[model samples]
Target: MKTALALLVGSVMLAGAADAQEKTIRVSYETPPAHIKSRTIEFFKEELEKTSDGYFKVELYPSAQLLGPSEEVAATARGQIEMSAPYFSYIAPVEPLMNIYQAPLVFDSYEQLWKFLETDEAKALAARLESRNLMPTGYWFENPTRLWGKEPLRTLADVQGKKIRTVPSEILQKAVEAMGAQPTAIPGTELYLALQQGVADGAFTAPNYGLTMKYYEVTEAVTKLDLFLGGYLVLFNKRWYDALPEDRQQQLMDAVAASRAFNEENVQKDLAKVDDDLRAVGQQVIELTPEALAEFRDALAPLYGTLDPQIQAMIEQVRGL
Candidate 1:
């Protein structure tokens, strides 16, 4: 009888081991196939597998293969996917304070943005992720925001009367309206068709995105407005992370930080390539003169008041830094 009991116990133990070994995690993104966002996800996959000795694996789904940007946060929270890299603005509806980073002209350089993100204000914002059952591992940089139009946009006056596609953010819509252009909020996927069909005239985006999305094919001019730093968040499902062993959690965090540094370095290099590619394609590239840039900045000043109080405070902290 004792021998029979031992056999049954051993069988249950083997089944438990098999269940643990079957664990799999999925990471998804909406960026185009060739974009840096895809590259970042690739890095995450490689590093996590290497560090965990193949015990932890990340399967990547790019170009909204699993869910669109609007649905990613909720899907992750519900454990439908293990992770997602979402644009800051798309997550703004869940955490309104996130729009602080989306504020026009708030960050003039990558260094400025990095410094602010390391502060208490940024930590406070990151803590909000816990309430939503998400963990913000780190951020990957998108190129500085700029304009793409069929015709050259040398100054704010040039954008007047043009119907521009923008994200459905109140601040961005207000900024576009204040600059004298009619704002049309559209999803990222629909942008190309909208521009080609004359449903919209032009839109604002990072140079790298333009290259990846083939915006240069439809738009002949690239304007360097550098109005806002496009930011993306790397998030993980809190439940999955919490279930991991302590050492495994540490390994994952270290890998993510290392990957983020690599991603930022690559972005700087790609920015130079984007400039060369735009010039090669016969797209007119225009840099705003100091006087004109200031004028454009002044026109969007009202956006500061439109931000949430927490976001306003975060901006003040960033400025003070």
Candidate 2:
């Protein structure tokens, strides 16, 4: 009996030591816990821990607790953080090819966006990110974003000179400006106050953001522009990822892939639910007439001509897809 007791204690000690040896990956993103991306990251954490048998653990810092939107890319590249899930456009400053996600009036459907992600142009963009010490795990596509504003945005003429909040992407800025709206680059955290105080007239974002941020209370109408596909790239520090054991690396990728699929499968439903929530609160949801949408599309066409040759080629590749 004493020998059996001694053996049991030894096994318990061994298990404790193994648990202590587990490696941890710290992930940061700029969305709230309620956001679809954040919810998907939660699934990744669960699947990773389960699939790895607790050999790896994930520490998540959502709502920019560990790093703000603008800081995530640089922080991850420098290995200050192990991972980040930021809007693909935010990474464009470092790898200009990533700006393709922000090009207006492209990607009519979620499936179309996924198809482009598998194309050669997408592969080239991934290579560019790797060159910057960032390795992409996967991409989580959000529902096509809509334009929410204080006033209805039905036709190109309605947007003229309206100061609309947008991300810090040259491509997007140019696209909005070409549509006759003055693009204002403001941080997401500041969007509510910006709109309420008249600092900006509106924004282009997903319905999830509208429901999460309660933008419906401030904005009068949301035109289902469905102008662009917005999404997040789950990126890891290349140096850190390269150092991981082969099995651990595969586990990470598998987790990301599973989470990406889960998010994609649920995003359409979530978008619909968010729209329902917005309407329940009395916000007007506008669906532009085909002619009105065409007018806006035509006004923004020159943006394609203004892109760099490489970027323009990539855009064409995606458009063709």
Candidate 3:
């Protein structure tokens, strides 16, 4: 009888072990799987599952399968979703300080951007995000936004009188106006048609956007303005994260670090390919000289003063980096 009891006890323990390895975590984002944002999450999923020894499963819902871009952060915060990668601009309205990313010429390279993100200033910003019930773990540098148009935007004067499609933000709109261009907020779905039909003269966005959405089909020139390094933030529900065991938490952070590195490397490589692909298709790729970029930067200087003081300080810190 004692031997029979031991066998039953061992069977129950084995079942519990099997159940423990079946944990599931769901992640969502608005971008297509081909985009870096979604690809980064894929890396995160891989690292997490490997690090946890198959104990964690990450289900990626790309292309807004679970939630739209604007709805991601709120949904994560409410614990309706385990994780989400949402555009930084979408969070700017709720947290005005986050607008530092939109300040033109603030971050010229991915290295500079990452250096600033590792600083205390970024920690405070992360804390602010945590206050909203979401924990920001990593940042995905989506792409370097540039000015592309029917004609090359070679000089500060080139932007004058041209209507450009931009993400509708007060700061961005003001920046566009300051550069002597009108900022038109057009949906991504309509951007290609807008440019093709002459509704807008050009658009300011990532180069991949032109490639993916086939904006290159209509636009003839692209200037590497290196205006702003747009990013998507990886967020987890704070309450959920806090509920994890200490070991589990450490494993998650480690996985996040690995995933971030993977993303940074891949994004850099992809950008180079995108440039080549754009050029291969007969698009005029304009590599801006230092002098020309300086002229454009100087013309947009007034925008620095328009930002909130804290945001301005953050920009200064990044510039110093």
Candidate 4:
């Protein structure tokens, strides 16, 4: 009995020591648990914990449970949390180059966007984030931007005289103008109320937000414009990430790479599912006729010409890929 008791105490002490050596990483984001991005993050947690062989543990604080969406980037940079996932636009103020995503209709597909990300310019853009103590681990795609409104906007002319809520993107503002809609820059926090109060007749956003934010309850129509792809990046606190040993760093990045592939495979299908789910709950999803689509496309054709020649060349290069 004495030998058995000693063995038990020794085992407990060993277990405690192992637990003390484990590193805990907390990742926070605002997406609902059912969202694919959220699922990808959960998968990330699973993969990291599995790959680390008891050396690491990841906890997910989703739907702003641990931190609000607006606080995510700053909190991560401050190392208050080891990581956070927020949209590119949310990070753009601190690192303006990320606003390359702010452009409209520049990327026609996820494949093209991935190609653009591999470019030297995109690499440099990511490198710039390190200056602010942020390191992007992986990026998850949002649905393409859509025009959701209280009224059905089936054609370019139909949107005329309507005020559309949009992000503070110069290119997006020009696109809205080209569509004959007055662009209104509404803070995202107040957007639902703005639509409900008739401050804006429509909004430019991903359909996923309509599902998660319950915007379908306030807005009656969604025109699938497919204007541009939007996505969020998972960021690690640079100090925390940089402090990891080489093999540990590679393991974390490998988990991120797997999570990214999972997200890429499922994101588009999940986007369409969100649209369908929205329709089931009484949101009017308007898929414009071919003629109407052509008209809308043509209306914005000149907007592309407004780009600087260098940017135009790059845009062409991205599209050609």
Candidates in order have lDDT scores of: 0.83, 0.84, 0.81, 0.81
Q: Positional deviation of 126 in candidate 4, in angstroms?
A: 1.4
For 183-246, candidate 4 gives per-residue lDDT tens digits of 9976555688999999999999878766777888788889988878878877889988887788
Candidate 1 global lDDT: 0.83
lDDT of 4 at 141: 79
lDDT tens digits, residue span 121-208, model 2: 7877787788889998889877677898998877888888999888778888888888888999887777889899999998988778
Those runs of model 2 whose alpha carbons end farther than 4 Å from true positions after fitting are: 1-22
What TM-score goes with each of the models?
0.93, 0.91, 0.86, 0.83
Candidate 2 clashing pairs? Answer: none
Q: What's the CA error at residue 45 for candidate 3, in Å? A: 1.4
After superposition, the stretches of candidate 1 with alpha carbons farther than 4 Å from their true spots are 1-22
Candidate number achieving the greatest lDDT relative to the actual structure: 2
| Per-residue lDDT value at 105 in model 3 | 80
Q: List the residue pairs that clash in candidate 1.
A: none
Candidate 2, TM-score vs. the true structure? 0.91
Model 2, C-alpha of 137: deviation from truth (Å): 1.4
At residue 49, what lDDT does model 1 achieve? Answer: 89
lDDT, candidate 3, at 99: 85
